[model samples]
Target: MSIKKLLFMVVAFTLASAAAQAAPLRVGVEGAYPPFSWKEPDGTLKGFDIDVAYEVCKRLQRECVLVEQEWDGMIPALLSRKFDTIIASMSITEERKKKIDFTEKYYDTPPGIVAKKNAGFSQSNMAGKRLGVQRATTHQCTAEKMFPGAELVLYASQEEVFQDLASGRLDAQISDSLQASEGFLKQDMGKGFAFLGDMISDPGCQGVGAGFAVRKKDTLLRDAMSAIIKGMRDDGTYKILNDKYFEIDVYGK
Candidate 1:
């Protein structure tokens, strides 16, 4: 081969290698939140949040590297630089904003109560019943305030909350309304379960809505992601994923 040709090939290969070296966007996710994020029996993650993350990465022209983190440790991991961002359906509460920044809300939904159809718990009163909720979630905060009299049964994961509820160990549970409906109520184990009363909306604990969370210093990345999220909503990409997981529009008014 000619020396000139060899030099040209070397430069092309170097450029290609550099392009390949572009860092992938490391996204934190919780594999236990169903309909939004969950692990299948085969250990593959698939859910609305998962889809949205992949879509956002595609628009950003970067490869996506999903890092599974427990729900309770999500924000701490992000702060510790374990991941660049969290796309795990985390709510954008003022309390959290004190610790990190959030992109514009991607979706909004209210929490709901789930109980056996025969259970007679009032919306305004549940003096001594056991109420299950995942630890460190808006649902926990909301339940504590809304049903101050009820005993809060804290669990590590929403799946565990559902399990206890299904076994009659819990009188009720408070969780994302859509998640309860799709993840538990619609399933076989939840055959006799139904949502009680109206959906609960507490701006204080539940926040305005769910959004992508990033380090406070990553304003540029947050803004870029916010724009991409807006684009997805305007271009119907958000609706496509929303419809895939929920029967109704979860992006609240």
Candidate 2:
């Protein structure tokens, strides 16, 4: 047999072997956040972030497995290898970068406050009114640092923060503006509450925006997802997703 033909066969075999060995990536998402990710009543996970994850895996020629993780536990789970990456709407903050690596901002949105229409809450004169935010989140950190005088309450989930806001246990709730808008203010339970104050931006706390979180050593997967995100944004898939889940560009200007 010719040496050229033998070399061709060897190359094809090696390529096939590598393809066969590549494992599906297990992606973690906080299932409680809507528009980004959530479990359907039927228990299947679906949302903008999930869609993005599946497409990214498709582009990389790998299967994507979705794992539901509590918002606060996502980083720990990733470090423990509970999942390969976190595609939840986790913002890319400086503080988080110390522990895990992140893809470029997949999406960015401002933070805001919510309160009963008649309730008076502001950065100024917030001494007596209480505020609530989801624990272990940028919102919690921002509220703590920004509202030094207000009594800040932290909840395990954004839903709980909204619950307390509705029940009057909290005079106000702080969260991602999009979540406060579409997730609560537009819903039945948000009947009397309205968005308060301007959209908040503090790079120290909020950073640029949300990104796919990966273990620090997993540069290959991180780079692949980042390329896919840039491709989607250039193409129109990202905008299509933004339109589907939200009325505004969550990716920010």
Estimate candidate 2's alpha-carbon lDDT, on a 0 to 1 scale: 0.86
Residue 236 in candidate 2 has what lDDT? 95
**lDDT, candidates in the order shown:** 0.92, 0.86
Q: Residue 161 in candidate 1 has what lDDT?
A: 94
Candidate maximizing TM-score = 1
lDDT of 1 by residue, 1-253 (tens): 9999999999999898656736689999999988899999998899999999999999988899999999899999999999999999899999899999999999998899999996876777788999999999988889888899999999999999999999989999999998899899999989999988888879999998999999999998899999999899899998999888888888888
**Residue 249 shift from truth in candidate 1, angstroms:** 1.3
Clashing pairs in 1: none
Q: Model 1 compared with the native: what TM-score? A: 0.91
Per-residue alpha-carbon lDDT of candidate 2 for residues 123-212, written as tens digits (9 for 90 to 100): 666776788989889988898888888888878888788888888899888899988888888888899998777778788899889999
Q: How accurate is candidate 1 locally (lDDT)?
A: 0.92
Highest lDDT model number: 1
- For each of the candidates, the C-alpha root-mean-square deviation to the true structure, in angstroms, is 5.7, 6.1
